[model samples]
Target: MSETVREKANQSLAMVEEVTAVVLPEPAAANAVVPLEKANKTQSAEIKRRMAEIDMEDTQSIVSFGSAAQAELQEISQAMLADVRNKDVGPAGDSLRSIVSTIRGFSVSELDVRRKRSWWEKLLGKAAPFAKFTAQFEKVQGQIDRITDNLLSHEHTLLKDIKSLDMLYEKTLQFYDELALYIAAGEAKLADLDATVIPAKEAEVSKAAEADQVMVAQELRDMRAARDDLERRVHDLKLTRQVTMQSLPSIRLVQENDKSLVTKINSTLVNTVPLWETQLAQAVTIQRSAEAANAVREANDLTNELLTSNAKNLRESNKMIRQEMERGVFDIEAVKQANADLIGTIEESLQIADEGKAKRAAAEKELQEMEANLRDTLAAAKAKKTGLGDTAGGAVPG
Candidate 1:
């Protein structure tokens, strides 16, 4: 060929290369030539040889070859992928198989030599890595399942313990309420007895003297009995405390040695129980003592009234003198009898008041002790519960 003709040919080829960005081997694969999504051995070797000839020094040509191969690989991948997708669209079993087949087809497509991976490289080519992923995934999933089991079991246990505590709170409240009512009733009864039984025969010295001594002895007996019963209830409350302490470890939060955890539990306990316990106790004490004291004061006022009335009657009777007695003047005997009856009623009332006082004092002491014990046990339970929560939530600390 002439130099000018050859020069023109070369320039034309370069222009075509720039425009198409592909420098194919002369007389390249034709439209009539079949394409394989999977490369045959000979075809793969030719692609490799052709790519090795192209160098970065000839950047234009290499990029052109890479582009053309990529386009060819893309078309092949699409056709094969569609064929595989049609064959399998079920669950995990078919999904895994489809992925494997897709990866094999991709490996065969790499015969184009310049083909690069797509975004689904990990997903489509999962044969080697998927096995390992599946193993670890199952293990992590198993861990989640175990954590779920712990959650359910812990929930049930926590609920049961909370229910027990609720019942204990109610029982404690009942004790508080009963103590209050008992003290009130006892005081009222004593007040009535005091007003009714103080000594109708104080004017009859011998009868009044005998009644006073007997009444003092009976008052002592009643007080002692009430004190004994109160002590017994206090003892039983102590027993309840002991039992609760034994169960404390199961829910104790303190031993975890986490200050935030311990503080949180303390806050919760103080918020939920101790504050209420104190409020209730204070209210009960105020109500019971106020009612009892008022009754006692009222009875004493009645006693003072009776005394004043008797003094008036005695003075009036004295004026009647022996003539009144002979003529039944002023009925001084009726006044004397009334004074004796009032004295007897007052004595009885005083005895009952003393008994009620003794019982209430015992109850207050017991409840205070119970409240302390409750606080301690609740703290323990909270510690345990916190420990359980941490264990359930995270990996063990190194």
Candidate 2:
């Protein structure tokens, strides 16, 4: 319960105590007897007046106070019933249920930083570990905002209900006080009828004539009936007052429930929400640190792999360089093979040259032979021509 409500309840209790102290006395004093005598006289006069006016046939008219009191009590009961009916807390209960459901729906696990990513997302460099968590955080923050608003609305409702219950509490107390007054008045009226009016009527009935006695006895009977009716009415009022007394605690209980709900709502808004937000922020920061550490670890591994590969390549290149530097520019085996090939080529050329020289010499010898034969044939032909020419000249001269 809120302090204000507690204080109001204390004040109400004190007021009730003060009122009770003033109204309920220990006993009547000796001086109070004079007022009692005067009250009895006044009651006798009132009873006489009522008897004079009341109809013998109509018993309802005999006790107007009881009828009025009963009517008033009924009215009070109906009004209280209406008030109790109107003060429905079903909506408040629903709001509380909704708030609880909203709270339950908030799961920190939804903000898991290690949520699985698709292969393509990783390959495309879109593996944002924080994106899902951030979205979930935003969604949860939105829920918190909605819950805060709902709690505020519920708090308002509870405060209003508490205030209304306070009024109802005061009203119930007032009804109780009124019922007490009614019961006391009815009891006093009944006492006056039994003590003063009925006895007087009985005495008159004995002294009067028979017909007058009959009338007096009828009035006396009416007075007794009115007294019975009033007694019943007072008992009913006491019962009504008992209901009001019971209602006081019921009203306080409802008021206390409202106050407690208000306190819960205020605590959620003031404490729980902020703490959750802070913790969520801390969780995000921790997750980011973990992601950074993982990234650094991956980078270190990549660097180590790159350095190892480069070292392997460097070792291979250095071995090749050392082999090249330790050897001459031309290999001795290659030079020796090249010289053998050159000598074979020169020998083959010399052999072809020798064969060509032999063939040319043979052809020259054949040409000389042909020339000598032609010279011999020319000499023989010349001798033969000279002889023929001499023989022809000799023949021509003869």
Candidate 3:
């Protein structure tokens, strides 16, 4: 194959390798396989081995999914589940649900899991123990996101640098080509100076007499100056080639750096990012699953509390109803008799008030008639006195 095609093929192979074999830095906390603080020496060593397995990027690690590590993780998770089940407090149901959900979610069918999986993918599938601590998984999720963001940013910077390197590489090649052309032209000029200009000037000096020697010497001096100028130009071009060769090292370094960055970016894009997305989905599912379990548990507790309170209330109400049913607190006969007596008293009081009102009306009529009779009698007496006074005045005038 041609050199360009061969280079392209190598790049493709490198990309594939980078994608499948991304080796990320291990998180400090996640590397601890178990949460046991006071484990024995043997257990601690075993835990360390498991943690190392988790960090391993090779398929040969025994702790990879479907391997012995899976079984060990399952056993540890089950033990933790049993401990939780035996406990009377804490979000036991929620914790159990989360663990079960994670385990089931991680276990992939043939259709879901591709035949060719990286060691990290296997490790992720085998990490059933992480399900037990949903909170810790969530915390780890944040860290993973931050790391992924940084890797993406790094990839961006690398791409920019690689672009710059490519531009520089092209410019350098162009410079070398132009310098080569300049050097070729300078060499040709040097040949011409030696073959023609120097020989002609020497022949002219030799043929001249002693009287013409001074003029020939001046002409020789000018020819020598021209030859020196040509030689200097050739030397300058050679030096430029040397300087260009010196710059090759730095260019190659940049090219190497560009290749390394490309490999890293490919790794992140294919492996690290995918792993993160899968784990994050698992984490979120576990969180929501735990929350749902806790919600159900809380609802059950509330229902029980309400039921108990209602039962107490019903009991108190039943007691009152039972008392009323068994024996009466007030006399029904007495209440009826009192109500009848009150109606009779009210009726009697109404009758007496009507009679008094009638009497008052008759008395007021009689008093008004008596006052009218007295006014009429006084008016008749005044008229008689006036007539008597009038008769007495007329008799006196006669």
TM-score, candidate 3, is 0.37
Task: List candidate 3 segments past 4 Å from native.
Answer: 1-136, 209-212, 246-252, 280-398
Q: Where does candidate 2 stray beyond 4 Å?
A: 1-115, 118-129, 325-327, 337-398
Backbone N/Cα/C clashes per model: 34, 0, 0
Kindly list the per-residue Cα lDDT of model 1 for residues 1-398, writing each as its tens digit. 22343343344333323323322222211121212223367644443444353332343443343333234434433543443344212232332333234323322212221234555875686433323333433443344333333322332333333333333334433333332322223233233334543332222334446658576555545544443443343344334333323323321221122222223333322242234335434544554565567679899999999999999999888877856567653577888998899998999899989999999999999999998777666666665777855344343224
TM-score, model 2 to reference = 0.63
| Best-matching candidate per TM-score | 2
lDDT digits (tens) for residues 1-398 of candidate 2: 23343344344433333322322212222122222234466644543443344442465644454345456546655655675576535665665566567556656564545577779888987736577677666776677666566556556655655665565666656556545444555555567678897888889889999879888888878777766766775676667667666766766666666565666656665556667778777887887787888789999999999999999999999999999998898898889999999999899899889999998899889999998777666666665777864344333211
Per-residue lDDT of candidate 3, residues 190-281 (tens digit): 56558886788789889999999899988778666655655564466556555554454555564465556556544544565456557657
TM-score ranking, high to low: 2, 3, 1
Report every candidate's CA lDDT.
0.41, 0.62, 0.52
Q: Specify the poorest-scoring 10-residue window by lDDT in model 3.
A: 24-33
> What are the candidates' C-alpha RMSDs?
72.1, 10.5, 29.9
